[model samples]
Target: MTAKFASLSCAAIIVAATHAFHPSALPSSSRRPATTTTTTTRLPMSFMADSSDYKADKSDFGDGADEDPDAAPAPLRGEVDMADVPVTEEIPVPMSRNNVGNRFLAVVLDGSFNKDDAKDAWEMHGDRIALTERHVMWARKQNLYNETFNLESRADVLWSHQLLSSDLQRAVGHAMCIDSPTIEDCREAISRDPIVRSLLGVDPETGMCDVSPVPLYRWRQIRDHTLRIDDGRDGLPNMVMAFDRPEAISDGLREEVSNDHLEYLIRSERVIAAGPLHVATPDKTDPRSIAIGTLLFFNAVDREDAIEFVENDPAARAGLYETMTVHRFNSLDVTGKFVSENLYFPGQNTYQMKEAMEHWGYPVDDLQTKWLNW
Candidate 1:
C-alpha cells in the first residue's frame, strides 16, 4: 500500500485554524508577496454526483460531445494493462479485497531502527500476523478464482518542515482540485497564504514555528480508500505492516532509506519494510518527531515474485535484517473520498472543468467557452 497525502476537506479545519492564529509563522513574504483573497468557486451540479453513480465510457473523453475540435486527444482511461506496455517483465495487476471479496489486513513497521529489530516486532504482533495470513489466504483464493493478486510494502520517511505547514496542506487540496506543477509547488503556494501561516503558528522571520498537530503525518500513511490494485483479484493482496518506535528501527537508518530508496519502493509493485524514523526533530514547542518507516503490501503473484527477488538479492541475503514482527490492522480511513467521487475528474466536456481551472488561477477561456458555451 502506498502512503496517500491528505485531502483538502480533511485539512480544511487545520489550515483555517493555523492561519487564524499564526500570522507570523508563514513563509517569507519576500519570496512571494501575498495576494488579495478571491471568492470560492462552485462546481457544476451535473457532475457533482457521488462515485456510486459514476458511469464512465471507455472512450478517451467520456461521451466526447463537449470536446473542443482542436484540443489534443485525452489519455487512455483507467489503468493500463502491464502486458500492453513495454517493460523488462510483465507487470501483473494487483489483487485485493476491493477487487475480490476477501478482507485486507495491514501491518505497519517502524523503519528508523535496525531492520532486524523492526521485523521482530511485526512478527510478535498478532494483528500483524493475522494480516499476513489474510494476504496469503486472499492470494490462494484468487488463484482458485482464476484471478491475480498483487502485494506490496512501503516506508514513509519524507517529512519536510516546508511541507508540514497548514498553508501548504490547503494548497495541496486546491492543487488536486485545479492544476499545479507538483504537489510540492501547491504546498509552497499555501505556505504563502497569510491566513494559513497565522493558523499554523509560523515564525515568518525564521520560517519555522510550532504548527498544530493535525495528525497529518498519521493521516498520510492511512488515507485513500481506493487501494492501488495491480490486478483484478478484488482481494488477492491484503496485508500491510508499518513499523514505528520501540520496534528497533533507528532515526538515522530511516533517513538514509528516505534519502535513498523509499520513494521508489513506494511507487513499485512490492511490499516494503522499514521504519520508526522521525519526520520532525523533537523541540521545545512540539516535542514529537513524526515517526518514519512503514510497510505496504498487496495480494498478487508478483508480490511473491518480488519477495523472491529480494531474498535472492545479495544485500537482503546478507542477514542485514535482525528482528521482525507483524501487527494486524483494521481498515485505514485515508481521505480520498473526493477522488472516489464521480465528480472527481471533470473532463473537457463539462463546465466543472472550466470552473476548476479558473479557480486555480488558470486562464480557462478556451475550455470555458467551448464546453460550457460561456
Candidate 2:
C-alpha cells in the first residue's frame, strides 16, 4: 500500500523511445518497460539501472505523477490533479441540565436558599436532571457537581418586568453555571465576578445595589412553579412545599395569604387533621358529644402550668387532643410580632435577611416584625 522513490543522475547522452502504458490494459510485468542502450565509450556499471529501481519508480507512479488510484477519475474533458486533504476536528459544545436528555422532570423550587433543604429536595426529587443553584459562589465552593446553580435574586424577575424580555431572564439563568466551594462560598465568589456585579448593578466599593420591588402577582407565579410538593399517601394533592418569607406575609391581605396559611403551618407541623370531630356540639350528658384535638407551640414561662391547663380544660379533657410536640431552641432573631413602636423595622435585621431583602429591592422603611406573621 506504501511506496518509496529515489532520485537518479545521468551524464551520458543516450535516449530511448518512451511509451505510456494504459494501466488497466497492460499486465503488471509489462506495465514497466526495460531500459537498454548501446554506448560508444565504456560506461560505469552504475549506469546500468537495477530492476529494484524500476520497481520502486513504478510503485510510486501515482504519487510522483500527481495521480490518485483510490479517487474516482474525472471526466475526459480535463485531468484533475489529486492531492491529500487534511481533515478538520470538531469542537464540542458543553452539556447543561437544560439540554440533557428528557427522562427527568425539572422542578424549580421558589424558596429561600436553605442549603440543607435544597440537598434533601434533590435527593428526594432530582431524578436525573442535575440540580444547580442560582448562587454562583455556592456553585464554585461546592464544586460538588458538574452543573451550575442559578442564584439570581428577584431582580431578574424585576428586570424582566421592566424590559419585557423573557430572553434576558433566561440568559441570567444560563449564566449561573460558575463553580463554587460551598453555598456561602458560592455567594461570595459570585459577588466577586465583575460581570455579575455589573449586571446586578452592585457597587463593589459600597456593597450596595438598587433593585426594584417584586410585583406581588409575579412573585406568586414564580413561587407556584418552583415549590410543588407531593404528599406521600393516597395520591391526593394535599400540600405544596415552599420557602416562606415571614416578611412577605401581610395581615388582612386575603389576596396574598389565604386561609390556607393556617393550614400550611399546621401541616408543616406534620400533623394529620381529623374529620368532623366537634367539642361544641355538646349536650352535656349526650354520649354523642365528641372532643377535638389540636397541636400548639408555646413559648410561655410556666410551661408545666400551661400544659396542665390544656389537660384539665373541658375541651382538652374531652379526649379531643392526643399530645403536643414541643421544640425549644435558643430563641434568637426576631419573632413574628408587630411592636407598637416599630423598632424591628425592615432594614434593621441581621446581615443575612437584610442583605437578601436589599438585594431584592424591597423598601426598608417602617417594616415591622409583624410583616412576617404567617
Candidate 3:
C-alpha cells in the first residue's frame, strides 16, 4: 500500500550521501579531470532513525582524565532544544545482499543526459525510491512467468532494483544489470521504468532513450580484508568499478594484450568482477554486435590503489583505451537479510576458469582465444 501524506509540505525531504563523476557526464571535447580520492565521509544523520534521542552516560566518557578547571561546565545533554540542533537528513541504508540469493545479477538502463544536465540530475529521492520499488515488484512478477532463460538458472530469485548515487556531477556513474528472463524482456521493463524515464532526457527526433545493458560477471567474492579501512564507518563503498573505453582503432592492441591484463588480475586475487560492456544487441547469439568497452570491479586499499591496478594493466600501458573512469561502487540488495560469508558469485572463480569451462561443456581452448581476449 502506498503511504499518502496529508500534504506535500508535510512530506519528508530526501538527502543523498554520495556523489559521482561519471566520464559520460562530459562532452567528448571536454575531458574529465583526473584526481585520486578516498571514500567520502558519511554525515551522521538519517530519516529512519533519530539521533536526537541519544542519552548521555557520563560513565562512558571515562571521567575526563585531563579535565580543564578553567573551561566552563558542559551543557546538560537533555537541556538543548531539538529545534536548535542542526541535522542533515540522509537516505537510509538499502538492504544487504547477505539474505538474498547469492547468485550473480545484472541491470540495464535506458536513458540519456547531457553534460550540462549533470548538476540538476542528482535531485529527487522520495519519488525515485517509490518508482523504484514499484519497478522491483513488477520485475519479480515477470521472473515468475519467465521461462526462456535466467542467468542464475534457479527456481526462485529476487531482483535488485536500486538507484545509484553520484558524488560528482554525473547522476549515474555506471549502468546496472537485471536478471530478467531474456534480453528483450529486460529492455522492455527498463523502458517502462518511471524513474528512468522521468530522470533522463529523451531525444527530440527519435523520442527514445539510449539503452545499455551491463552484465556483471562476478569472478570472486568480496575480500573485505583486502579493501582499505576507512575511519571505522558504515555506508562507505566497499568495492570499486572502473569502466575503460578502448580507443576506436586500438582493437588489435586490446585483443593482443587482454590476456596479460586478465593474468595480472588473477594473480592479485582481488578481482570481484571483470568483463566487457557492449552495445545492446538483438540477442546473445547475434554475431554483428561490436565491443564498446570493458568494466573492472575489484577490491583495493583505496581509490589510488584501484587506479594504479587498472592503469598498470597491459592494455592501459599500451594506450589501447581512450578513457577510464573509476567510481566507488556499492551493490544494493534486499533488506532484512544478513550473512557472514560474502560470496559475490557462487560456484565460480576466475582463478579456475579452466575447470569451470570444462564443467559447462565450453571449449577450453576458447578460454584463451575468446574469454580472456575481451
Candidate 4:
C-alpha cells in the first residue's frame, strides 16, 4: 500500500499482511478489529440450519471452476446456517464443494457487508461490482495505453516489465496467501488489513469475539477461496471476456474480420492475455480454427477500449458472434508474471507426421531474472 510495501521482503510482506487483517489472534481480546456489538445477538444469515425449507432448487451448471460448465450443477453441499458453520477445521474448507445450505443465507452473506440494505445483491456474483471498479483503477494507475504508447507504432515494445516481472508474481502470490481466508495458515496470515477488516464489519484494531461473528467467518471462508486473480494492470487477468461465434457465420466472413481484429488486439498490447477457444477435445482437425469468439483479458482502465474494439469489430458488426459473456478469470498456475513460456503453448499438436509446440516470438529477449537480480 506504500513505497515500503515494495521494499518488504517476501517473508516480511506476509507477516505484515497477516498481522494487519487477523486481529483475533492478537495478545489481548480488546485489541481485536471489530465494533462492540453484542456477541449473542443473531446476525444476518444466522438461520436455523435444518427445518429451514426453501423453494425447490433450480438446476445449475455442475462443471464449475476447473471443469466443464455445461455439466449439471453439483448438488448443494454442507450446512450454511451460521450456527452450523465451522471456520477452523483440521480438514480445511473447500470452495466449490462448499455451499451455503440456506439459500436465504447465501443471498444475504456473499462476502460483502453493506451497512445499509444488508440484503441487497451488492456483493453477489463474486463481488462483481467492487472488483470491476478496482480493475479500472488498477489499469489507470498502471498507465496502460498511455499517450506515449498510443502514439508509438504497435510494432514497438511499449509495455514495461516493471510491474509484469517474475518478482511481482511472487509478490502477488505472497499477497494471495495473505488475502486467502481459507488458507490453512490464514489464522496467522491475516491480522488487520485496514481495507479488508472494514469490509468484515469489524474494527481494524479491535476484532470481535471468535464465536460471535459466524456470519463474518462464514463469508470470510467464501471470500478467501473465491479466486486468486488480480486486476489486469498487475498482469493478472481479473476478468476474461469471451465471445462466441454463431453457427451460421461463414469461414470467409470470420477470416475477413475476426482474424484481423485478433491481430490488432495482439499487437496493440493493451491486454494481459487473449486467445481463441477451439475444440480441445479429440475432434479438432486444427487447433487454431473452430469458429469461436475471442477471449480478451484486461484491467478496468481498458474496459472501454476493449469493449469498443470488440463492438466495432468487423465480425461483431456483421453479427457473426451469437453470444457474449464476461466473467471473472483467475489464473491458478500463472501466478502474477507474464513469462515468455506462458505466452504460447509449449508443444505443437502437429499431427502431420510430426507435431511440436514451438516458442512464440523468440523468448522474451534477454529476460531479467529477479532471482539473479541482473
Query: If scored against the real structure, what TM-score would every candidate get?
Result: 0.24, 0.17, 0.45, 0.27
Q: Using alpha carbons, what is the TM-score of model 2? A: 0.17
Predicted structure with the largest lDDT when compared to the true one: 3
User: Which runs of model 1 end up more than 4 angstroms from their true locations?
Assistant: 1-235, 242-251, 270-285, 290-292, 302-322, 325-374
- Write the residue-wise lDDT of candidate 2 on 1-374 in tens digits: 01111111111111111110001000112111222334565323332265453233343235456766688645443332323333444323223322221111011121112233443323422321222222332222222112222323211110110000111111111112222222233234445433333334466688854321110110111123112332222111111112112222223232233334344433443222212111222132344332222222222222233233233433233322222212111211111122222232333445454455345333233222223221
Better of 1 and 2 by lDDT: 1
Instruction: Report the C-alpha displacement of residue 209, candidate 3, in angstroms.
Output: 8.1
Better of 2 and 3 by TM-score: 3
Residue 259 local lDDT, model 1: 31
Q: Which digits, one per residue and each the tens of the lDDT, describe model 4 over residues 1-374?
A: 00000221111111122111111110111111222334464323433558675332222544235766488545344323444444432322112211222110001112223344344332333343344333322322222122322221111111111111111121111112112213222222122222233344554476642212211111111122122233465323422223334443445555666566655555544455444443222223434335444444554332233344455555566665544423223332211122222112324222321111112111122222221111
Q: After superposition, how far is residue 159 of candidate 1 from its true place, in Å?
A: 23
lDDT score for residue 161 of model 1: 12
Off by over 4 Å in 3: 1-22, 25-132, 135-174, 180-182, 200-251, 334-374
Which ranges of candidate 4 are over 4 A from the true structure?
Answer: 1-240, 245-251, 286-289, 299-302, 327-374
Ranking 1 against 3 by lDDT, winner:
3
Could you tell me the lDDT of residue 141 within candidate 4?
23
Identify the superior model by TM-score, candidate 1 or candidate 4: 4
The positional error of residue 313 in candidate 3, measured at the CA in angstroms, is: 2.0
- Which candidate would rank higher by lDDT, 2 or 3? 3
Better of 1 and 2 by TM-score: 1
Question: For each candidate, what is the lDDT?
Answer: 0.29, 0.25, 0.41, 0.30
Cα lDDT for residue 293, candidate 4: 40
